[model samples]
Target: MTTAYISRPASAPLVGIGWMVAAGLCFVGMTVLIKSVGAALPAAQTAVLRFALGLPFLLPMLPALARVRLTPSHWKLLSLRAVLHSAGVGLWFFAIARIPLGEVTAINYLNPIWVTVGAALLMGERLPPRRLAAVAAAFIGALVVLRPGLREIDPGHVAMMGTAMLIASGYLVVKRLSEDLPAEVIVAMMSLMVPLGLLPFALPVWQTPGATELILLFAAAGLGTAGHYTMTRAFAAAPLTVTQPVTFLQLVWAVAVGALLFGEPVDPFTLLGGAIIMGAVIFITWREARARRAAIAAAPDALLSRSASGPAARGSSRG
Candidate 1:
């Protein structure tokens, strides 16, 4: 089967950038809410509530969900992905509650590195030399940020790293599913599945949240949902290379928010490490885009050659 990778129109890059910026802002807002409300809520409970709150927004997609065709294999994959995602979110909530918001966000940038490794090992995708170098550089940057020997490593840091690994695994599953399923169907299933996965974990530690905490959690749910939707739209509008760089803005926003709102001082090490990581990710994305473009450019010649051979072979056979 032929695979078509759509290239956006020239004008769409700007629109994608706008959506990415909005997504960054929404993500920062959600992080802030998580940090605030997490003080009074259990991590698992908060995760469950966040997904529960977001479910209403997805209710309209039920008809679309019903139309999706799924096999037992698909359901198994979906369940695995959901479990990974729920665990990741729970760990993230726990990490944010204990660590500085800026540090947590910086650590989360490790996701791309995890994605690179996962794709190579799990998907059997070849990692070009440049991407391999990029991954190495990103890991060095993470080490700089953590400075394991120089500073005391907190459990929160470990949790964030685990979060990155699990989330990256879930993303790989999404990539596989996207080959056969609509993006909406994948998202809708996730919306339903994560909560169900978290319900048992949440029930054990559930405490009645006050009015303010409830509102904050709901607000977080809204921001997180909006961010994901906008980010997806941005990717659809433009190539990954074009939109991925825009996400670096989230680190800046996270640092600023942490400093201003929570009085968490800016750490130069974190900023430098984050910049390095993002730079590597951007380079990797650019290389991938170039490779795809080359492939797309050559496809027409390939098709023409095949067509030319077909007619000549038929004539020879007839003669």
Candidate 2:
């Protein structure tokens, strides 16, 4: 089954670029907020608060959810995704607390690479030679960033890697469910579910946040939700390949934010590694788009051949 994406208005690529830039800003802002509050609360508690507080913004979509007919299988997949997402967010919060914001953000770029591999393994999609090379290059880039043997590997690094993998798995489920469900419904369900899933873990370490922390958390949630919405709009407006490259700006913003706000020195190795990873991801995205277009272009010919053979096969059977 193919997903029917909502039709978007024909907008200029510039408009998509603008939305993408806004999304980068929002994402960076959210990360900054998370880092700022990391010292005050436990990761799981922060994750719970984020989703719980953000639940109100998602309420408007509840009416839309009523329109979606969800099966038992759909509910199961959604529940699994919720659990994975909650875990990913919890890990991310922990990583942010222990690591530089820039490093955490840079490492998170591994999500797309993980998604590509997940597609191959879970969806049985063929991994072409070019994508295989891209995957290798991405890992090499990761090595450059981490320099694992040179420095003692931190728990934060492990957490971020696990976060990427789990999140990627959740995305795979999202892709499958998207074939039948509206994006709004999928997002809303995840938003509602994450808080519930994280509540238990959060309870043990929960502390009442001060007014400033509360305000910051709320703002971060808003930015995160807005970022996702804008990203969706951008994808709808323009091709994924077109907007994909713009995302690298987030890493730049991350570096700047870390340096200015946290007084973390900019690491050249991390920047180089992030650039390499981004390059590979961009190439993979472009290659996939090309392949998809080729498939679509050949589809009509395949259908025409089948149609032409139909009458002959029927006559042979009759004879």
Candidate 3:
């Protein structure tokens, strides 16, 4: 039996971090294009278009997809994850169109915190006091960003909150499916299934996209898909703990994009809040790493469970 993670080559962490940085740049570019498009189309339709346009990228993986023979449980989890992902993507599109780019990216830092809370409350995991405090601190960070009572809460803010929670729930299901399935299969299945899930919602609000809109959407889709690929490569290179911290760098880009592209001012509260939530995420991930190491020590030669969530680690930030 092999370990969950093998010995790394020299500079593996740096290499993994380099890929993570590349992925971040891709995601930032995708977000800029999506925001540039604004709300030209309904969120559901926009989401469907992005995924539908992204279909061709999956073509090369057709053989790998064809070889899969999933049990009923796998189908259930995949379907469930797709549905959650569909909703999350729609909400994300809507939110990004309406909110400041930096704020959108900042709020996204809460995705992992949602998963941590979900595990404890829904999955019966023990959330020791420290983890519990971290969750509380994460929420405080969110409040700082939102500042609900101090100002009128935008519908976009509401949508983004739902986006984080929904996507995190999907990650939970992805975790189950990932155990026996390869990451490629999991990603491909999600790519194919999410559009189908979004179809019903997209139909009512569908508007024919213009040439310029189509070209921009296609570009955004390509970048987003590429980001997912590079993120997966980062995971394959090193553990989540190493790449996870690198994600905070995206906030820097988002802030720059917001200021330089959209004229959105730099909000210090958003920056501080993002940092706080990022710290909580790093803490949670560090703990997860410790737990995995202890488990490996207890059973050194056990078959490694394929962690289903390398890209999911960044969880819809690619949008």
Best by lDDT: 2
- Please, what are the lDDT tens digits per residue for candidate 2 over residues 154-224? 89989998998999999999999999898889999998899899999989888988988888889999999
**Cα RMSD to native, each candidate?**
3.0, 3.5, 10.6
Candidate 2 Cα deviation (angstroms), residue 299: 1.5
Please tell me which predicted candidate would have the highest TM-score against the true structure.
1
Candidate 2 vs 3: which has more lDDT: 2
Cα lDDT tens digits, model 1, 1-319, are 5666677466499899999999999999999998999669899998888888888888778888999889998998899999999999999999999888877888898887898899999889999788999999998888888899999999999999899999999999999988888877898999899989989998988899888888998999899989988998898788888899898889988989999999888898988888888988898889888999899889988997898899999999999
TM for every model, in the order presented, reads 0.94, 0.93, 0.89
Candidate rank order under TM-score: 1, 2, 3
lDDT of model 1 at position 251: 90
Once superposed on the true structure, which residue ranges of model 1 sit more than 4 Å away at CA? 1-10, 313-319
User: In model 3, what is the error at residue 276, expressed in angstroms?
Assistant: 0.3
Q: 89 in model 3: Cα distance from truth in Å?
A: 0.6
